[model samples]
Target: MTSSAPSTRIASKLGLSDRIFAGPRSRRLLSTVEAGLERVDAALVRELAMADSLANATSRYLYDAGGKRVRPMLALLTCQLGDGATDKVIDGATALEMTHLGSLYHDDVMDAADKRRGVPAAHEVWGNNIAILTGDLLFSRASQIMARHGEAAIRLQADTFERLVIGQMHETTGAQDDDDPVEFYLRVLADKTGSLISAAARTGLTFSNGPAELEGALTVFGEKVGVAFQLLDDVIDLSADPDETGKVPGTDLRAGVPTMPYLLLAQRSDTSATALRERIDDGVAQIADGADPELLDDALAELRDHESTQATLDLAHRWSAESIDALAPLPDGAVRDALTRFARAVVDRSR
Candidate 1:
């Protein structure tokens, strides 16, 4: 799994331009993620081959838009850390990533997102029906991989998948309601993002027959980091260059999804959020390009300056610290450092 350091292109993109990890150890962890992608591709191949021509094109569009494949990497790293290394464990890692990608395929349709990972989304290129079918196929393949392990792994994966779907539905409900509290948003993020990451780490433990206590600790760590990740993503959406984020800014705002930043801003303002929403609806038709751009920019600036952003960052920082602490009890080595650095890396990611 070990290999050389990342290229300058990767280093710059990952915000590792400085000596954050700063040594050979960081390189090995990065190499492991790259290596995991190779395994993930093999699983993706089976799903893609089973799809119809249009579906195949849509699936391939997503495949070509390479991502970090963090879920699989998490499984692999944790497996090694727990003194559990086997083909089954590797397959488990692959399965987790497949499920994650599958959900993204569906999410694009649900989000009506035109792009993902800087490329056109599958649903945008292909019809919604094909996009959904492709996602179902991926989900099936993930299940097949899980079944190969045993009943226990199969059950875990099944339960996780169920939770994932439920989380998606919960988020949709919140968006439709439009007045959801920040706490509800966190709950949706946990079920949607946290459960999978928690399962990945726990799957590694299952392979190793590691202590129950350790598994529970890692579960907490995963949930917290998952929440932190989404918060940072929201923060980035409000501030990062559209080119860098690979999406339109104020997208969540436009969709009327009450994210933490927006919720925070509304809380600070004298006007009620419901009243503000009504105004936006009424005013949208009349907003001139010149006037609207300036107004939107000012609103975004205020949202960024809201105490909520700092509060959210503080929470992210603390959770990342706790993630490292949970793994601290593991034997100290480059493997441990790699995971810790990964947690730190997520917090500081530029895009």
Candidate 2:
């Protein structure tokens, strides 16, 4: 704590949800959050440290580079519903972040991404085998930390990991001929991205002994927010700025990964879209053969202007709105309003 914790504070009295804008209680709670986040950051570094030199370097790479820390934030935020950021909540938040960082390693390897967080991807620097091992190590460490929190934490971590794997698998295999690509991709978003976020929210409630009734609503809310977040990412990929996004625009197309905008384009039989899709397919092939990602520039530029990009944006907004609706069970107050803002803010990035 920047300021030492009180002997104890009544969780409900903090009134963090409704008074976020102004009030002595709001300022106190904000300080508590700042202190909690700082502790989370430090704990992540300590957890990533290892006795083995190679493992230490690889495992710590992206965690050190930095992230939005959204999952950890949600963990801490929901804890306010109960006892606030207890030591257990902080540890759970740190573990939640590690779970996310671990997935990045596997994602980079699958996408053949060259960089992450403004640095070379682990696979790029250390080769895929080493990178994959490092990711596994992170997951293992997260599990070990969860062990401290008992069975519920362990179970949550396991369930999230299962969904993460399923989502990645579906993304990798792609939609079958009979499957709806848009729906498939949304499901991918749910499992791959949403599941972990949902678990993070659950961690706060489960670990902090928050209201039992809010669990279902929070779970749905987290998943929808996750889907919305990824849908926005689909738009972001086509309009990437290296300095801002840490990856070039068209990285997904170049890597031949399917995206919502591209999927929308594929569904159309329009002469113009069909022509553009063919060209993108050609560029993606070049990338698969080790060609420059910039080769996709022209097509991605076209995609940015295409109606499909707008369609994707609209889809994101819909999901975001739905996430807010899921907060219905939450008492109508600052907490629910704050979460609504959070849902909007999550998908509003780069808009």
Candidate 3:
């Protein structure tokens, strides 16, 4: 089920190799996607290379660290429904991936994170001001690429960018007094993660002239899959070893971020919940004040094994299933099958 060298990392990282090469048709599709990804990778290097040496180096930092390239792959996969990767589709894919990479720089800054893709975060290396500017540069470059595709692409890019900002704003502000914490968290996930993913899939279809009728279904699929992907990330935050996920376990908890498991725990009124709640509340404050690492580690271990974490995993599976269901309207073929497999793989991150 493994692939050869270059695409092997992407396929293994995403657990997509088996599904992608499952059948002869799927193998052909995989070859096509790998080829497009190669082009996208080249474009990433060329696009991020700026006349300003500092900007170029800073912007290229995360790109060189390596990522799963899921966004661009989603864009490429959807393009198979119509004509395969045309020049416009490749440009759109490149733009979408650039947008994703830029968001990571800003995200690490916002989270005060130390590492990304196994390297020091851009902010950690170059300082917040330089890191923020690098993100802006990449974002502008993405817009410039979209602009070449015409007004519609520009509008889509603008709208997606707006959603991304609003999502971060809501996450920063926290849920309002009357807001349902779970519902609010889901909305934030949709805005921050799902919106851009929907745009990525739709952009491929738009650029490659995929069937107009399937646009709505693919959009729904992308958004749901994106939410599922992030929810699984929430579970992974608690469960995955740092080596596996490339993130410190319980990083969100330490930051006082409201992950799905935490939000779910907040809703429980039973006696069993009281001790965990107290531990979390106290642990968060202590970690913020540089308290005992042993205490925080113990609390995180308990929370990771808690029922609430399992519930979050269940929700992720539900979303993944719903995403696959959205693909029901598409014809039965390799593309549809791969999309379904992708949805399942998105949730499978919990393993």
| Model 1 regions more than 4 Å off | 1-37, 83-85, 175-180, 208-213, 269-298
Candidate 3 Cα outliers beyond 4 Å, as residue runs: 1-9, 290-295
Report each candidate's C-alpha RMSD, comma-separated, in the order given: 5.0, 5.2, 3.1
| Model 2: residue 251 alpha-carbon error in angstroms | 1.1
Give per-residue CA lDDT, model 1, range 59-93, as digits (tens): 55665566656676567667765555466776787
The lowest-lDDT stretch of 10 consecutive residues in candidate 2 is 1-10
lDDT of each: 0.68, 0.82, 0.85
Candidate 3 lDDT at 173 equals: 95
Please tell me which model should have the higher lDDT, number 1 or number 3.
3
TM-score of each model, in listed order = 0.81, 0.91, 0.95
* Tens-digit lDDT string for candidate 3 (54-88): 88788888887778888888889899888889989
Q: In angstroms, how far off is 299's CA in candidate 3?
A: 0.8
Off by over 4 Å in 2: 1-28
Q: Between 2 and 3, whose TM-score is larger?
A: 3
Worst 10 residues of 3 by lDDT: 1-10
Question: What residue pairs clash in candidate 3, if any at all?
Answer: none
Candidate number with greatest lDDT: 3
Backbone clash pairs for candidate 2 read: 17-334, 18-334
**What is the full ranking by lDDT, best candidate first?**
3, 2, 1
